[model samples]
Target: MTAVGDARIRRAVRAREEGSDLPGVWSAYGGLLQHLRIRAGLSQQQLGDAIGYSLELVASVERGRRPAKAAFTAAADRVLEAGGVLRVLQDEVDRAKLPRFFRNVALLEAEALSRFSYDPLLVPGLLQTETYAHALLGAHFPPLDEEIVEQRVAARLARQALLTRKKPPVVFVFIVEEGALRRFVGSDAVMHQQLEHLVTCARMRNVELQVMPAVRSVHSGLNGPMVLLESMDRRRHVYVDAQGVVSVRSDEDEVSEFWLRYGMLRTQALSTEESSRLIERMAGEL
Candidate 1:
């Protein structure tokens, strides 16, 4: 038997003890992978060796004890001659790894035709750099497990692919409070990288980034953060997340108010060009 690394074993043990309700997608993916491996007459060790991964990792994935990384799924698909079957589930698998409260909203956002959001504190996830992501997650309260943090960071990065997806042609507008950007998250260096990244994202054809000046104490968005998006079905929805609790709704009466609020917030925020310049200046100061 392959030796289970101390870290991995600890995470699995703690997760089991906590009795967290993991998403069902993981078990489904693991079961499907196992069936394919069995049909191919390959032992777990053989498959791991073929895919250049550890046998313990393979067993962990196969048993639904850990989520498979995209690279792992791709390699397993290729070696098993599964003809992209495993690849089809990659997005859902990644989504399942997110904090439970955010999973449903994330799925909806991934398929959005247009997404508009207002954030009073912190840069939105889509614009975060790897280092920034690491720092934010590492500082989570109650402290997430090392394995859990890695999983969430990877999932957040994966969700960013929606920004450039061409088939659906999603449009995005992000309004962030100037004070939020000015506030230090991880460190000056990390914030600098993050601000530079915001500039890069703003340059994207479909992304419009705006900043809400700190001087504005009273605004439509002062209430809290809100996301308004048009789903694949062209229905508008509202998403509210605070302190890890999430609320999502498609009721036209309720959603309409948020859409209107976001509209006002956009008008109140600095123009995209002005926001981009401000972000560059902040990066220089860092």
Candidate 2:
């Protein structure tokens, strides 16, 4: 069990004791767990002991204030003789761990035949190293529980597996701004490792890496970052995330405009060789 909102946990526990309807999926899951625990004649502390967690953690999860990990659900299923009832919800819980809006993008990326992205703020998830990702998520403004941070980091790393598939996308292009590379994330050592990883990824046969030089006075991507996906059926889509909102567009006219802008970005950005050299130099500087 991970520490979460203590006040909410207490309120939820009271609601469960009072037999009120649980509002959300997480709350429903917690209510079910509590019912199972009572039927099994196990106290929260007893369940915690059986599951190798603390009493507070068990109570936190039971109140819907903490996300239940897959391992915890599996153990609970067995301990409570749930006959796979709890285990069945593990996938749903895992998916819920990801930011709600980005879920569709994750699914689409897996099916895309070709993928291209231009990132100006930070390293794209697919290109980020584990350390870089951990540092990035750890700095969340509202602050996430350690468990949630690790869950998000795991989700981000899992997305990178697409690039290593036996038959990956036909073309994978990443256009990173020069300022993005120079931005400090984590520590100097972490940045060094991340840049080295970028250099290695650039060498992949199907991958194309380009850098938008900082010296450039004007560029087509000045508006913002965008990702274009070409599915196996030849359909194209564009994904854009501004602030916290995410939009995916499949309209031909809109996607074509993005495609044309991407072409211009490619023309204006440094070649793969030059980008790799720059990345190597940056890594060496660290």
Candidate 3:
């Protein structure tokens, strides 16, 4: 698990107990605090000096031990010389959008130049449509009311905007089984629309989609789905989302193992062209 995992899980359990969904907000704010502190090259004590708080307070926020107040955010923005970078996190926190695990994923996506994603169950967030997102979120947490459901949908849709931005990042999505396409989340109409969208999105220059058909006798990804994000500075991080989010080390050994696994999965999967045709045919059946 990464630095955010235990804290997020604790927050999630607490939120359930409190009958609130504020854990995600708190997690995102915590991520922002870490990012700014690192970017500003400020040690805990230095950050405290800049923000007029004890180092313990800053540490508490970074660990999600405390909720970030509006004043703390504003002060951090100025002290970190972030201009308005930290302010962006405020909007998501204010809306209480973005899942606790996904808040870290979003931060990585924003800074990444290329992302390698493998999904064993559903499509990745950067590729999901609003309708598909709603269906998935509803299934993930069946008790959510209409209001929270809509907010989750909006949050997922907002993630897709990453692909359309001026300097969009490269995305690679690998799927292990075709059943993910057959399992209709919403109605047939919604599933059909989503598959069609996937076909279109897969054709984009920066996006690469592949599939490991069930017919394959063996697969390296049987261990599970993992994503590797490469930053512009050439740093690589592998993230796996299960019950929670876990980030693999950038150490050569770990990254090499993931690369080997990912390479084997791709080799076992159908070609991009083949996957595209398969998706189109599945959409037709829908």
Candidate 4:
């Protein structure tokens, strides 16, 4: 499961378990640990044998009720041939209040050198204004209790720091459909504020924003909203968020195709100057 999905489930479970939300999020950390063991071709008994735990303890980890140790993660990484992906996140997990899955994404984002995104519906989380984000989050079913909403929004807003940090600024390129620009997600005032913020954010040196005109007959982004993230280590991942599903892929060919499509879409989009003017015009209509 994606980190966001894991976080959703963790929130539900936590709400029930504590009778109120706690600041710490621990989505399916146990399950991820167990899956790593299974993928490493180790039986539950074998994993228990290596980690000096009973098979029942191992089972508890799989069920998300218990926290796995760093030593266990290191041992599992070696056995699983994960090249320290688990180890790196394990370190951050120690200090993080973010859910397990979200922590993984944070580690990945911290290492990323560039990101390219397309959003056909709402603004991407990394770029959302607080008001816009809160309004959208409030609409989620099983409605995020106030504390959870606050935490999630704060977490997302914190991610924007990547744009300004020293050296190798996280290059960001965004493409949004004209329809997204037209939608008034919140009140007219809130939506107008968000659009104006988009205009200012787009002008940042390391950021690029483009709008896909609704009238275009031939477009490369027909498949819907997707993101292509690249790290300095030459790794690539494809992320798609649609129909209440968010997925990330590390498969080379799969991400490569999305990268190619993003290139084509960029070519068809209006120049940055034109897009800014277009956004400003839309903001005026509000």
Candidate 5:
């Protein structure tokens, strides 16, 4: 009788877990997609064919098992005549793909007029290549599901769009430790590609990339990685990420200190031209 009671409890717990695990926004988007398709008298296969996607892909999206990319959403919306409703959910759907801890920061970043970051270890997510990001997440200690990994990778790439946002473009400053550049997040080829990509990004007029030499014995950035964001209203915020934990501060005093530290780190690090040359050299060595 006790064994049967325990079995019932286990089943109840599992059911509740499954309920909480559902991707709410993705599911809503999926349901809307289904409604639109059905209203148009189109089967999943027919819709997939019209949108140039596979039937399985369409079915997966309809079930919320996969989040649709912006391109996919646009194509589907056009094909289904969604009248822009599907496109409206694209931001929320993309935000859901990022880890919960980073979502708020991501939102603040989108509104910022300038972003400055000091990365002592891994390359900042904003600047990471897809292959590099995949390898980094793939090495998470507890192990992430393959699907979750894909979602995170796609989400990371999505954030890179901010790099090119125009009409009063955002300014970007990146200070990366030399060691982080040398560390192999993925294969040698990936590291090489990433360094080359960095060089490319640094060439952008709105971006300033600097390299902190490993030889620097002591520096404030050694404390960990921190991101500084200045909103259009000139309000500044500081974001610090250590391990998996994160802290965000809006207090002027605290944020000002972070700005001071970042300024020091920038001066201590290589100039943009030098950094670009160094990155090019590193890519060549790989």
Candidate 6:
């Protein structure tokens, strides 16, 4: 049993009593973990011993005070003989760490046959190096727990695997603002590593990396960042995120508008070779 004096346990109990929907999915998932643990006739301490965690850590996760990480959940599934029930929730848990609305975008991204993105701030997730990602996520306002931060970093890195799949996407076009490259994310060392990674990604046959110059007289992307995705079935969708709210549009008219806007932005941006040169120059500065 969790110590009654533990702050996390007390907070979980209070939230439960207040009927707060905060962390709803995670709480439900935690409940499922608790149920399975009991069914296996394993005490929390016993489960912790088997999984190489502390009893309090197990209790915190079971009560929804802490997130169940991918590795921990996998161990639980195996120990409890859950038959993949717990393992299947790993993706959901990862998605839950993202802005609630962006979860859908992640799903679409995974199945996209082609993806085009125009980013005016920060490196796009798919192109971010692990150190850059950790720095970016660690800087979130309200300060996420270390466990949650690590989970998000893992999730972002996992998404990059799509680019290396046996049947990689036909096209992956990324137009980044010149300022994003100039801005340091974590440290000089981290930025150097990230820019180096970006240069390598630009060399991929199916990838086109362009940079929107800061001095551009006419900028179509002044409105904000957006992504255009074509699904495996050839259906198109547009996604825009602002102020923590994400809007995904599947309407043909809206998608067409975003497609045209992205084309104009790409044309106004530097050529691939120029972008590569710019990236290399910035990396050299680091």
Q: Model 6 compared with the native: what TM-score?
A: 0.85
lDDT of 2 by residue, 22-82 (tens): 2244564676788788878999999989988889988987777666877899889989888
| Model 5: residues with Cα > 4 Å off, grouped in runs | 1-19, 43-46, 52-55
lDDT, each prediction: 0.86, 0.84, 0.73, 0.74, 0.87, 0.84
Q: Which stretches of candidate 1 lie over 4 Å from their true place?
A: 1-20
What TM-score does prediction 2 earn? 0.74
Clash counts for all predictions: 0, 0, 0, 0, 0, 0
| TM-score (C-alpha, index-matched) for candidate 1 | 0.90
Candidates by TM-score, descending order: 1, 5, 6, 2, 3, 4
TM-score against truth, every candidate: 0.90, 0.74, 0.68, 0.66, 0.86, 0.85
Q: Is candidate 1 or candidate 4 better by lDDT?
A: 1
> Model 6, residue 62: what's the lDDT?
84
Instruction: List model 3 lDDT by residue over 76-143, tens digit each.
Output: 98887777766766655533456555676677777787788788777776778788888787877448
Best by TM-score: 1
**lDDT preference between candidates 1 and 6, better one:** 1
Give the TM-score (vs. native) of candidate 3: 0.68
Q: List the residue pairs that clash in candidate 6.
A: none
Q: For model 1, what is the error of residue 114's alpha carbon versus the real structure, in angstroms, after optimal superposition?
A: 0.4
Superior candidate under lDDT, 2 versus 3? 2
Best by lDDT: 5
Q: Model 4 Cα displacement at 222 (Å)?
A: 1.6
Candidates ranked, most accurate by lDDT first? 5, 1, 6, 2, 4, 3
**Poorest lDDT segment (10 consecutive residues) of candidate 2:** 1-10
| Model 3, C-alpha of 212: deviation from truth (Å) | 1.4
